[model samples]
Target: MNEAIKGNILTPSGWLNGTISFGERIEDVAGSSSDPMLNSDDYILPGFIDLHVHGGAGKDVMEGGDAVHAIAAIHARHGTTSMLATTMTAPPEDIDVALAAIGKAVRQRGKGEARVLGAHLEGPYINSGKLGAQPNFARAATIEEVHRLEKLAPMRVITVAPEISGHLELVSDLAKHGVRVQIGHTLGSYEEGVAALDHGATGFTHLFNAMSGLHHREPGMVGAALAHAEFAELIPDLLHVHPGAIKGALRAIPRLYCVTDSTAATGMPDGEYMLGRHVVHKCMGGVRLPDGTLAGSTLTLDQALRNLVGLGLDLADASKRVSTHAADYLGLQDRGRLARGAYADLVVMDRDLKLKAVYIEGERCDLNDA
Candidate 1:
């Protein structure tokens, strides 16, 4: 695999006109090249890192196995070179099994994204009050539960309601193990939000969705997430969040990371879908429940990239959000950059922000390419 993969490289630092070489192993990358490259007018950026993604291309992480491979390959086509296979709230035992199975799949990586960094368990211990669309059976995580699950995966992240019982202690415990605790789907008050943040809770899950609403005087969860600018995840599919709110939140949380909380229905046909035990309908270009509760998004990373730029986000910032910002969330130093030594995962997109090609460790991928 000694090939120079060249493109209009866009790093968090800025864009560069050079070639990046890939070696056989994960750490190998060529630093310099003298060959003249072709003009693409394309945005060649680091391959996207989606920290929170359930399943796509008709597979769910909970159904772990070849489905993991199938869905990941599908998403890589959309430019996600790396991701944390997110699982929905489910029975504790089921969660453990799913985690273990995914751990194996990732260790023996075949197809799909170049790398499966780890697993993101959305919850088993979450506040039932603001569960939003998360399955009801998998309740919030307790301190005892965290101790068990953290040992099951390489990387771990969870979305919790800070107001739930054992929430603070759980955050502290998880943090001690290097597991990132995200605040979301919560009904916590503004003060509670801050309190949770104090416990080394690095970021928010999906801001302004399942959590408490905003009140000028009270300043609920949204207020807390916005007021704390260091970190928060935004599902900028325009459907999950309003365009204006997306722009405003990005402004408020200067270090906002964009994600697609997309489900198995993402690349599938518009029809019936299942999110945990709930039967969801993928219609009108978005997934929804019987009462029209927005289930998941149809927006791809490219769409969100365009959305961010449309909302006045500069290339560098948007590039960071889609790349290194996510890596930062997981504390991964190797990815999210186009430097000489970073993993050679890359994405090439047109000016209109359409994904044309994706490379994982210098291997060209994009299911449609075949």
Candidate 2:
């Protein structure tokens, strides 16, 4: 499986105008001027790692079967090398079915698909008042229930409303078990958000959406995260959060990463699609519910990078927001960087940032079928 490619390779130290050699893992990254293969005008950067992905390509993860594989393959075409199969809030039996399907996808990653790292349980333990696009199945979480679900699949990330009954303690317990807890879909106050962080919740889910607002007097959950959080996820589709607010978050949170938060409408034409238990319509380049509330997005990571760059972020910094910081969030050291001894997961793009090629564990993807 040994292979090599030459371009302006991005590494931890900086960009190197040279060649990178690898098998399943990178073996070497060296700068050279004389190699004929280095003549291509391309940029080599780390592949994207999306932490919040529900579904895509007209298939919903909640469908629970080979649909996860279809979603993974569609995202892989868009340069996502690894992702979490994010689950929406559903009834217990439905959630179990979805988790079991994701567990299988994690165990056996299909060819030409993004690596399904694990599940991101984003619901069922959130506030009923702020159930943005989520069904009305919100309830308090129990440690026993979480433990049983984890047995079906690794819960890499879980979103909880700390203001819910006993959820602060649950956050601490889940953190102790090495799960990355996030605060979202809540009506909690600023003090409650801070308390969740003190209890070991490390990140905020989709900052500025479905959470409390940031007023000068109130300083709600958004304010707490803006003031104190080191890491948070923001959907960069330009529709979810305004570019101005995104800039504010960028100035505030040091490691503000991007997530697709994409639904089954992604990679498909404008039409009706399923997002969990609700049926959403896609039109005017956005997906929405019957009441015109934005459900999920059709954003892909490649477009997310372009959107960030369009917002005046430099390419390198934007790449880190889309790739490096997310890998850092999940403590995955091997997947997000292009360096020796790292996984050979990378994306090749032209000067315009359009995807040229993608590699996952040294296997080149056929973008024609993407």
TM-score of each: 0.92, 0.97
Best by TM-score: 2
What lDDT would candidate 1 get against the real structure? 0.76
TM-score of structure candidate 1: 0.92
The lDDT per prediction is 0.76, 0.94
Model 2 scores a C-alpha lDDT of 0.94
lDDT of 2 by residue, 3-59 (tens): 999888888877788889999899999994442244566889999999999999999
* Candidate 1 residue-wise lDDT, 117-199, digit = tens: 78877876677776777778746456766666756766567887888877898888788888888988787999999999889
Q: Which portions of model 1 miss their true places by more than 4 Å?
A: 24-40, 138-140
